[model samples]
Target chain A: MRAAIRSEWTKLWTTRTVWWALLGAFVLMAAAAGQNAIYVENGDVTTASVAVMSVTIAQLAFVALAMLVMTGEYSAGTIRATLSWIPSRGRLLSAKIAVVSAVTLVTGVAVGLLGGVIASAIVDDSGSIAGDAFKIGIYLVLLGALATGLGAALRGPVVTLVVLLMTIVVIPPLLQLPDIAVLNGIADAFPGVAGGHFLYGDADPYPPLVGLLILAGWAALAVAAGWQVLTRRDA
Target chain B: MSITLEKLTKRYGPTLAVDGLDLAVRPGRVTGFLGPNGAGKSTTMRMVLGLDRPTSGRALVGGRAYDSYKWPLREMGALLEAKAVHPGRTGRNHLLAMARSNAVPDRRVDEVLAVVGLTDVARRRSGTHSLGMGQRLGIAGALLADPPVLMLDEPVNGLDPDGVRWIRGLLRDLAAEGRTVFVSSHLLSEMQMTADHLVVIGHGKLLADAPMTEIMGGHATLEDAYYELTGSAA
Candidate 1:
């Protein structure tokens, strides 16, 4: 298992895709934090909320990178080569999920901290953001794992990215319709909306534990579905 | 030490890719898997390597299923498609990852690269390589573990004449080392030069499995026998 993880780590570094995605994430986070800081200066939002929102926007980069981890092998036709070495499909899937999750966890924490510091500096607010930043970081780790699983199930980049963007950027806003109270309530159940409660404390309907379970459940279900496809189908 | 397929069948929806084919590829000789286009050669090879799941039946390597091997590459080496690699990665990294997976040594990776005459460009990305060079790199990867069974598909597809001769000699030498070499090719003339035994199939079913000489009885060459058997040659 260590060897499999090592192999996956090497693969991630050798390809330029992951590094580029990380850089993209950092840039986007810095920009979003700076932009949101200006909005806070106009008393548009609280310092903590601005910090959390910036990190959430930046998590998209980590999600894209994680999705590429699995899709890269498929697009390059290297999955067959990978499966050739490790005949056990489940082991390969676990190794990939492990590596992507570990890397995203580290990157998420760093970006969350940096984004918060930038927001504080820009707005001249002396607010400490460790609590909100930590929650955002955890959200990123789960989101990255979910993307990895989705990438495996949907091998094409266009389809996987589209599906992910719809879930993240499109569906959450659609569920925010003012007329449908029931629909708005269910919005908290989506991985995207549910995870936001962690950063905002009591701002959401569900408690932190419930939010965490819902987000983790999304990742687990995606991975289980991907595992079934990988084990049952030919590479 | 051999690859055995027992009633191996693979169906992709309505298309029967491999239909209940049976054969044994033992060590100490070169056995060529020959067929026309869409003759299930690649599908069969994929099944043997466990890349594709057979709808029914199974393939065994050295009398055991492939997943049962503690080190699969140490038991069977496959060169299915030369382009079945991450193009952005260098040849060295490509082999390094596979080596790490099976605990094969770095020294072995270097040795195989040298053996395949790819040591000079080992650091270059595989996507930059020509088709023939990429094919050689794939062969280098297949030789990384020095496994007992060797499986290659169209081993000489993009090679120049000299490279083709080099591969023929290499195949023979590997067989002489008592490794089971199962190579797939649609070109009859090429198979005649490299294979000691033949397994011919068409439309997902086996047509012949016999020693090359026995199958070539009363024919000018193995190509003539292949034409009679597969009915492709005029």
Candidate 2:
């Protein structure tokens, strides 16, 4: 397991995709936070809120990074070599999840804290940092896990990105617009909604803990399905 | 070390890729795996490497399944296909990752790169490499762990004459050191020069398995024997 993790770490950094994704995420986070701080009414939001909102856009870059972690191997035909080396499908998937989660956790915290500083510098009324950075870190880790699983299951960047966009970006807004009980419930159940509730501290339907658990559940389910496909299918 | 296939069978949705193959490839000699296109040479090697699950029976390396070994790469090394690498990564980094996966020493990466004469170009992105360079990189990977068992699929696919000659000498030297070498290629003349034993299949079925001299008997050349064997099987 340790060897597999080491190999995965090396694999992730040896390519240009991870660095580009990270740079893009940081840039997006900074721009969004700065814009929100400058343009929005000072009393309408806090520095933490600005950081949280900024992450919604920046998280896409991290999701793309996570998806590529698995999809890249499939596209390059390197998965066969990888399997021949490690041979244990479950261990390899676990190593990938661990590596992706660790990197995204650090990236999310860094981006969140940096964005908060940018917002607080621009807006006088912006609130304190508090636990928002840590929350964003956790959210991004689960989100990264979810994307990695989807990448493994889908095995294509475009398809995985489309499905993730539809669920996390497109479908959630439409689902929330109806305001019906079932529609609201379904929207709340989605990982994006649950993540938002957790990050933005919305406790309407459930506590922040429940929101985190809901997103975690989705990630676990996706990873389980990915493991199934990975183990059963021929490389 | 030896590769033992026991009743190994693989079927892909009504297409039989390999049908009940049973053979033991021993160490101290080069075993040539030959077949026409779609004859399951690659599929059989994939099964041995645990890339593809066998539909029935098993492929054993050194008396156990490939995955069962704690350090499979150290037990067996393989080049399943040319350029089976992430194009964005440097060839050196690719080999380093493979080395780390099986706990092989980091220095071995440099050693293999030097052995394959890729030391100077190892830092460049593999995407920028020519087909011959890519084949060399793949061979470097297969030799990274210095395993007792080595399996290569169509290893000479994209090599120039010099690269081909280098590989033939490398295979001979490796097998001379008592490592089990299993190489698959359609070039019978090349195999005739390198292999001590031969395993031929046609349409997923074993057509011939014998020593090179024995199979070459009563035929003008290795190519004639191969055509006669596969042609009759077809």
Ten-residue stretch with the least lDDT total in model 1 chain A: A197-206
Cα deviation of A230, candidate 2, in Å: 0.5
For model 1, the local distance difference test gives 0.87
In Å, residue A168's CA in model 1 sits off its true spot by 1.1
For each candidate in the order shown, give its overall lDDT on alpha carbons: 0.87, 0.91
| Candidate 1 runs further than 4 Å off | A47-49
lDDT at position B101, candidate 2? 94
Total clashes, candidate 1? 0
lDDT tens string, model 1, B10-127? 9988999899998999899999998888999999988888888899998899999887776799998899889987888999999998998888887898999989898999899888
lDDT of 1 by residue, A40-85 (tens): 9888876555667786678778988999999888889899889888
Provide the interface RMSD of candidate 1 in angstroms, 1 decimal place.
0.9
Q: Whose lDDT is greatest here?
A: 2
Q: What is the Å distance of residue A52 in model 2 from its true position?
A: 0.8
Please name the candidate that would achieve the greatest DockQ relative to the true structure.
Answer: 2
